[model samples]
Target: MSDSILDRANKGILGLKPYEPGKPIEETQKELGIQNIIKLASNENPLGISPKALNVISTQKDLNRYPDGNATNFKQKVSEEEGIKTSMITVGNGSNDLIEFVSKCFLSEGDNAIYSQHGFAIYPLAIKSTGASAIKAKAKNWEHDLSLMKELIDKNTKVIFLASPNNPTGTVLESKKIEKFLEDIPSNVAVFVDQAYFEYLEEEKHKVSFNLVENYKNLIISRSFSKAHGLAALRLGYAVSSEEIAEFLNRVRQPFNTNSLALAAGIKAIEDKDHISSSIEINKSGLKKAEEAFNSLGFEYIDSYGNFISFDSQQDSDLSFDFFLKKGIILRSLKVYEMPNHLRVSIGLEEEMNAFIETLHDYKKALDAG
Candidate 1:
């Protein structure tokens, strides 16, 4: 018999594992045969979609026509709000798409990309898809050790991915520390900072270095409307960089990477300050409540700047995850992040959080008794 066709696949892809997203509500219902499921797994905004965005999406009348390939108006809105030039902005189907665009534009065979341990999974996936090496630096206290990352950089390094308020851990890098690190690195290496959760941070913790894009030609900052703006379903996000790099990314991106509805909705979503504020407030309250519960239960949790919190299960997290599913709750297991004893839960409405807390206590007790 001939060798399997899989043997002819790209060498880089053959070694890669597919990303495991949080379980969907419908999938859980089917598997566990339970309804009334509340999903606190995907780190989505539980407050639901923004009314302004919905209004814009509903009024979108050109379904028969193609979307604006250039994403002009949305880019203009972002430029005006962020004080960046429109030429420096590149929109994508989602922030993940933007990540892939960067990889496609810069990474190649024998090249390498650097990211910290427990950084967003897409970083390595995107890099490896381009047949590039992904160098994971050792994390310090679940945060990016910038010095270690710098040491790992070599002539072969083409890009560096930094996730502030990193996923699964929610640890953020200090603004000045990141600036110093950037200054120390070689100018030839491109730096892509994934700030998907930037809006959830307190005002004081916000990075002034976002404006450094104007000065640093190699810097790119990716932002999303998915979290605070409640536009995840729209799949709208963008990257801000120097005009030169933006041109390269745009050249590699699909002409209609962002749809008409997403463009219209994103323009409205960014202007709805009240909705964003309310979302942040709800997250803050829910995070506080969850933290208090974890403390009383003697569970260890990372100090998170983002909307979700990862807590140690003190048992097999996969088993605990199954237990929660049986109880009509869906939380994220960190097995994919290589933290099998921890689970992450997104902030939801007060009642939803209460249910999660009560169910968690019950699960822990059952485990202890067993």
Candidate 2:
């Protein structure tokens, strides 16, 4: 009898807010009538696209035909690199698509999925939109509290999303800790690890061996080429999981979930080991630049293992966020993550970092005098 449009919409969606992404540089420039914008908002590679991927763009043909629905070649390439069978890989538009696929595959009305308090926003958007109950476990010091997460598990729970080198805060759950947590959780519940920033993690400490999946059938690992491979524009992501889980995920995935260019580019990007290395090197150097700048400002920051850093602005983030925008620097506000006083900045080029540092210094001086 209800005439309201929202009444027809999924009830769970009623309780959700739209996911707000970082503002694009072009949008900011057009809005402010300004130029020379440097964006540290999205965790994007400053190095841009891989040279190998760029090479394939010119070779792609057949605009008249649909892309490979199975993403056969791409899946085969991933299987080769990961040392897994193609049956175990699920291709997605982006890692976000993989997240949604898992959510839709397992969750329905009255079911619940769990994620950390400060976990990636896409987890909730993907899970809750399926009309499933989205549960949040309390985070300790802006990091996933696995014990608290375990305490929240109940019969209705279906999936648990874990993000290492987690977004916004950049906290990580070590492999040993992850294995222990997996051992404690119910075997029936799927655990989707969103590892979008997997390549950015330091090899010495990250230790995320893909062989972990061989032992845990319920485990699903989603990764994106957007961050480290500089392929954000192409919308390339995939999930590694048990064949049964991958089969179910594929059933719900769109036939052409990815485009022709994305498939070709993904293959090329994976082959360009040098490009991956160069991007990582730039990230490492940029992170150091951020540390020196933040330390000079006496800004209290979370120690991050990712390519970005989240720090306390020590004031309402709106003022600083807008201040940076006005100064042609674009980073992100953590208000959506429940840390309204924090801001996250993706590490940029050396010159861009220098500009950000100088602008920050100027802002402090102005704040003091005003």
lDDT of 2 at 27: 93
Per-residue lDDT tens digits of candidate 1, residues 1-370? 5878898777778889999888999988898888899999888899988899899888899699999999989989988898878999999898999999999999999999999888899999999999999999988888889999999999999999999878979998877777777799998999998889999888664564557887778899898888888888889999999999999999999998899999999999889999999999999999999999999988999989898999999888989898888899999999877788999999999999999999989987997899
Clash counts per candidate, in order, are 0, 0
Q: Against the true structure, what is each candidate's TM-score?
A: 0.98, 0.97
Model 1: CA > 4 A from native: 1-4
Model 1 collision count = 0
Considering summed lDDT, which 10 consecutive residues are worst modelled in model 1? 202-211
For candidate 2, the per-residue lDDT at 316 reads 78
Cα lDDT of candidate 2 equals: 0.90
Query: Which residue pairs in candidate 1 collide?
Result: none
Q: Write the per-residue lDDT of candidate 2 for residues 1-370, one digit (tens) a residue.
A: 8578868888878888888888988999998898899999999989999987998998888968999999999999999998999999999898889999999999999899999998999888888899998999989988999999999999999999999989988999888888898899998999998889998877645756667888999899989989999999899999999999999999999999999999999999999999999989989988888888789888888888887999888777888899899988998999889999888999888898899889878877877777
Candidate 2: list runs displaced more than 4 Å.
none
